[model samples]
Target: MPRTREPFWRRLLAGTLPLLVWSLHFAFAYGLAAAQCTPAGMRPGGPDRALLGAVTLAAIGACAWLAWRAREVPRREDAGLLDWARLVLAVLALVAVAWTGVPLLLVTGCA
Candidate 1:
């Protein structure tokens, strides 16, 4: 039997899930940092930090799982232009993460 093709939106979602997960991580990290530094009595090395750490780890795990599932999808030779656009956006996101940490460390003098 011939394999059934996945819908366009479903395929797009599969490819984009990693970006969504990483964006959520960035937002959560920024919010956590702000919360820690703000004058709200929420210390950095407390229960809140622990909770955020757990949540972040779980997000990472979920992202990995989604990526694996995405890889299992059958490739199409005739994707629409929009699909190509989404793939390009996903590549840019991956590149952003790859390059961001080094500059972040250099600017912050963390290295």
Candidate 2:
């Protein structure tokens, strides 16, 4: 049987989605931290660690889901470039999200 090819746009989207999520998470995390630390921007009580943590977890979960879906069913022996790309990118994003969240555990308050 011949291998079915995915559309160019779909392959591209799957491959880039993980990286995009990672980038967004990076920007949001740092931006939130910076904003919270600023005297004028700080929340009434303090930093919102819970919200940040929740977002981190959600990002990690999304990346994991993408990676799992990339594996696909039927267990093909010969996966294409897009398949590999999607799996690799998802795992990379998962690690990046986790690493980015590390400061949340170590740091408390803006000080």
User: Model 1: which residue pairs collide?
Assistant: none
* Candidate 2 residue spans exceeding 4 A from truth: 1-5, 43-46, 72-75
Shift of residue 100 alpha carbon in model 1, Å: 9.2
Model 2 clashing residue pairs (backbone): none
Every model's Cα RMSD, please? Answer: 6.3, 3.4
lDDT string, candidate 2, 3-103, tens digits: 65876787799889999999999999888888888988876645688888899999999999998888662377787777788888998999999999888
Q: What C-alpha lDDT, on a 0 to 100 scale, does residue 5 get in candidate 1?
A: 85
Name the Cα RMSD for model 2: 3.4
Off by over 4 Å in 1: 1-5, 44-47, 71-111
The CA lDDT at 37 in model 2 is: 80
Best by lDDT: 2
Q: lDDT for every model?
A: 0.54, 0.85
Query: Where is model 1 poorest over a 10-residue stretch in terms of lDDT?
Result: 102-111
Error at 2, model 1, angstroms: 15
Per-residue lDDT tens digits for candidate 1, residues 18-101, read 678668766765565555556664553422545555656566566556544444223866666555645555555555444432
